[model samples]
Target: MVKQKSLTNDNTTKVEFNNSVQTIDKSICDDVNDTVIANGMHLRHTMLTLNSFRFTTQLLRSLLMGFILLTSLNTKQLAQSSNLFNRNTRPSIECLKNDRFYRDPNRPVHKIWTNIECSKYFLCLDGDVFEFKCSEGLLFDVVRQICDFKQNVDNCDITADDAVNFENFDLYTQILFSPNNRNPNGCPIKGTFFVSHQYTNYQFVQKLWNDGHEISVHSVTHRGPEIWWSKNATIEDWFDEMVGQANILNRFANIRMEDIRGMRVPFLRIGWNRQFLMMKEFGFVYDASMVAPFSNPPLWPYTLDFKMPHTCTGQNCPSRSYPGIWEIVINQLEVGDFTCGMIDSCPSQLNGDDVYRMLSHNFKRHYLSNRAPFGLYFHATWFNNNNYLEAFLRFMDDLQKLSDVYFVTQQQVIQWMRRPKITPHLNTFDPWGCKPRQWESPEVACSIPNTCKLRSRVLQQDRYLYTCNECPTQYPWIRNEFGLD
Candidate 1:
């Protein structure tokens, strides 16, 4: 038996075999360099001893074959080590140089990339790179370009066991009632009224908020031809229309800005990426506008970090990614052979039993399958039909009997998406539990609300503003969101 010792330095490895010694330089074997350095010394001694003994040509050939086999094993080990090193290494900030935004300052500044570990992301802005870390238990989603729950990002090292198990058959239901007009007479059964500042009873809106219903923005002017939202609307148009409504709801209805977390595009006319861009910048959590195909397993709400999973059914579906903004798809309801995007658009002629059957049929598709959040999205005008209203109430009553069904607001649904819970544990979920309203001012309550009439330059007529607080000199509209005179 030969005693062997090996020593490694920056550029070479020295090996001593008994009294014989040899040094292997790093440059000779680039692919198998590390392996050679580790075992070359011991193998060198064996070759030398065999050579001195005048070994047969066949024996020497066999010895050479053994050495080749040893090198192959070492090569595999070295390759695995290299891969491990790459995984552990933090990606360089210079990696941003490959992005178009870094190369061209005129390009959009929304460029983002993640480290190999997916624990943090790097944002490129004005040719500079900035690092940001994901929240606890979350990972940087490369597809969506935002920090998200671990289960949503496919490449994450974490297991999906932490997510809510779908086998439990839990169904979350959300009702999104968008009232575009504030008519004093209330929503008409026939047609929508003109958008008004006055008729919306602020006290009633406040009561809804108080009752734990989510107050989401529809639009300040729900103006139409309907094509404007899908075609001519710009990002600024969305900011004014949606954000302006939110401002009015906050000032008059006393709904907190943080609580108003969602928006539905007028007429379900998606403004492509424009509306989503505004939603992301303005802290809105989700958009319940885009329509999905009427499929058996309906589409679930998903983040805009990657391309949309379904085809763009409505006009101008978002083509760009708007990370962190959730898209609650309006999975179409089947009525006979046709499908309607909004539940209200479904045949209103149906009897009470028929209405119940239609809703139950569509709902079971989600309930029996992936258990995606089922939505009942409609305008308040839909309730004007007595049969439709009665059947909807009956449907709600039936759903309440299920131990696993929960009727939640859109904001609450988004919260559940972030941290999902199994049916058994959902009872303790904090987001669903109602708490007392946190009013910014004590004047949020109004025993006698003020009705202010102000001249509007845009409308060229007097506009009404009903509020619990002091009325502004001018009624709030598009650019004049705060109702400043």
Candidate 2:
């Protein structure tokens, strides 16, 4: 929303500007150091929140595309003249201020947030997301959590105030890139997107979709049962929420709506079979409303799914009650509704920050592990114009930086699940080498040939190990890749 002027002159060429994007500061780049550093701390977290994702700046041109070398800033925003031995550490206080991502060496500031890669950082440009060049703050946040640090800010040789800046000693988890680089066409990537979904940033949604992020419908109206979810929810509500959501989403970017491909229950609340019925009506490829009893998502400490393992035998697997719908249960393995708090009917009215931490933990963990889609249950009210919403979005923006986790709709996951449901041939090293938990087949579908359905059941392995009979091959899928085999 902020505006800035393009300081680049007529002679400024992309080649020339690209050459100068590496420097952190110049004489003119002053004014907002603290803001830049703090922001950078948050931005750094975004870049490295989830270690499972590996971001590559591949130009997805029609033909054989050339690679674009994206430049990010050094983790240390400020040049520590005295703290040369700090090594990879930067002052938290200063680094948290006016730091930039994908910032130009010549120009060191992000005028606005946007999806545009930092071709050149000029004091004049503008956008929302600065750039995903590197991850510094990410290391700080994740490491601080799992690791134990006791530097004693003031108690040490340095004063308490010095601890915020001179502190070092880090790293809890590091990124491990998967071997698969030839991702599918619908894979996740950063780009400007535009879409037309209900009460959503249609343009933002569309941009995210076009830019390779998963675009989906949150709800038809994004309202509760009385207004949009009720048995008597009206055509108007449908127009405002359901149809409107689809229309906006369909119009999202220039992409065809036929591949928009995802949906979730508006309020994470659905009637008996209402969600399934709606998934059909909405033409979604998958529905993520199936948060059954167990879900082995890759993330933890917030939402964890621990269920008793079952068995998936020959034809007697999990039964499928509906067509093209997978029941995605939010397994609160770390902590969820039962512990911290579940965003129920009045989630939007909630006034707690713990909700975000809980949600973010799952997202970060899943991203790091390249695990399955994280089922985030939130109500429309969660995005209301309130402090809660502001904090939530900020937290989300940081989460986005953590990893290239696909922000898919339930439909998309369902579609992926529907694609040739083959179990990974069990290998000796496959988690204690135990057989996959079997699904419960329906009485009617017994030995029915092609119609053999897979029922929902989580067969537990040993202590801390479990997989779904329905999706055993890839017990946890990330970036469309499964680890089951």
Task: Tell me how candidate 1 scores on lDDT.
Answer: 0.58
Off by over 4 Å in 2: 1-201, 224-230, 234-240, 251-255, 290-320, 340-373, 376-485
The per-residue C-alpha lDDT of model 1 at residue 199 equals 36
Worst 10 residues of 1 by lDDT: 160-169
TM-scores of the candidates are 0.58, 0.32
lDDT of 2 at 342: 32
* C-alpha RMSD by candidate, in order: 23.7, 24.8
Model 2: per-residue Cα lDDT over 1-485, one tens digit each: 01112235532212112122222222212322233224433533532321122222210110001011111233243221111111112122122122222222222223211212122221111122221221222111111111011121100011111010111101000111112211222232221111222123223333233333455555432332222353444434443444455553343223355655655453344434444455557665544433334344442211112221332221111232554444454444344454321344323333547556656665666655646556555433334445565556566566545433334444434444444222232122222122333322321111112211121111111111111112223222112112234
| Model 1: lDDT of residue 274 | 82
Itemize residue pairs with steric clashes in candidate 1. 143-305, 144-305
Judging by TM-score against the true structure, name the best candidate.
Answer: 1
